[model samples]
Target: GTQSLHTNGMDEALALPTEKAVEIALRTQQIIANESGVADTVDPLGGSYYIESLTDAIEQQASEYLAKIDKLGGALHAVEQGFIQREIQDAAYKTQRAIERNEQIVVGVNQYQTDESIKPELLRVDEQVRIDQMAALQNLRAERDNDMVQAILGRIEQAAHIPNAPLMPLFVEAVEAYATLGEICDTLRGVFGEYVPESWV
Candidate 1:
């Protein structure tokens, strides 16, 4: 899957991808497909014992982690307990530390030194965009039947508490009734209180 990489505005030190960088990324994929003949092979790294061992190890570890999560009363329980969040935070911290210490060399970041002036145009969302969105939402609410929307929302709230309830059909019905996303989400939030993560500090 081809996708664009986006950099955060907060990371001022990080340089945005230049035209040359974008060309290189696309060209690299083309080289792999044509020159390397990677596309011709069904399983390129299939014969490598190291690769097979690594794959098996990764699968085994993932299965073990899933079993642990199941024992901890599944994914929702892990999230509520901040187990999943902590694991992600720890991994991110480790990766960042590695990059900072030059243990991991990222090209154009820690390695490739370039002073070439590259100013790429960045996309910015204007305040009018938000204003327009709000106006549209307001117009929708004004045109929709408030009584019917409330009734549907109430049914959704009830269905949420009921086990094995086919809530997707109810959600589709709510959408068909012109119920705004905010209204439906707010109803669910009221039913299931917002999760507050445990202090890791």
Candidate 2:
């Protein structure tokens, strides 16, 4: 699945009743689990000529990349300088071109011509859910001790300002003080200012 499927519209996906979500997940798992001969076999495509050649080529290419990154002072430095992002973009473009030119055949997407419309039941979040969540947040803030929260937040601020200081403890303390995920993220955004990369023009 695309990362967008999980991160971008996931809250709406999860807004289904918990039981329905679990059932859907279980069904998906079962389909994957029961895929023909996958479970009993070790290296299912071991004997396929094309599969072996492609796998070896991919492995060698990855090894070359690892070696290049090591020569360039490792993964973190490469990431900070956008090497990884550029490589990913190049690879994605190459893959897309291959698919478009029929060099690749992706099942049900480009290869299989399925005329059936995919009409799955999409779960919707009601206005009451939003209202209830706001009320819950307000109640939580009202019930929690403000003085302790402020003290913890001060400790968090101190940790953020200090060089090489582990901020996990401050995070734990904030969580213990009943600070919401949104609040923690907002505070970090205030310190870090959000990072937006220059996408390809």
Candidate 3:
């Protein structure tokens, strides 16, 4: 039985879908659920041998990947060492290669493509909005207690270095004192440094 449904609007890849596109997507889902009669059945492919085999293969592959991560001292260490990043990049490269080679088919993309140029009209943010945001942020900085913000930010930096320190309260305090997100992140970044991934090329 289906518990949920996700129907993407056409041209969702480029930007936020238009209202007409979203309505069309919803209508398509309604048609499939009400008219197709598939929703009347539960566990339609529960006893299928092909589906069972596919499920087993997925489980086995996932277990193997988990074991690999465990060997590398779990997820954090794996990410720090760039194992996860490299795996993602490699997988993406393989998928792109397959699509280019026609081993994988994406309708309207690599096969049975339309000749007409599809130009989507994307909504643009006005320059005045940015100017207003900048002014508001500057006003906030001037109005808020900068001294308190600095003191809390200092505590946050110190807490980050200490093992197992509860920093959430300090974060809340910092935010209440009008500390900016970038300032807090920058302070933490100064302590932990940054992760620079190897060049994919």
Judged by lDDT against the true structure, how good is candidate 1? 0.81
The global C-alpha lDDT for each of the candidates, from Candidate 1 onward, is 0.81, 0.76, 0.91
lDDT of 3: 0.91
Ranked candidates (lDDT, high to low):
3, 1, 2
Better of 1 and 2 by lDDT: 1
Give the per-residue lDDT digits (tens) of candidate 3, residues 1-201.
368889998868877787778889999999988998778788777889999999999999999999999999999999878899899989999999999999999999899999999887764567999999999999999999999999999999999999999999999999999999999999999999986776644
lDDT at residue 9 of model 1 (Cα atoms):
41
- Strongest candidate by TM-score: 3
- Top-down TM-score ranking: 3, 1, 2
Residue pairs with clashing backbones, model 3? none
Give the runs in model 3 whose Cα sits over 4 Å from its true position: 1-48
- Write candidate 2's Cα lDDT for 1-201 as tens digits: 111222133234445544555666667656655865455565666689998888889999999989999988999888777888898899999999999888999887789879999755567667999999999999999999978887877777667777888989889989999987777777777776887776642
Model 3 lDDT, residue 201, Cα: 42
TM-score of each: 0.73, 0.71, 0.79
CA lDDT, candidate 2, residue 116: 96
TM-score of the candidate numbered 3?
0.79
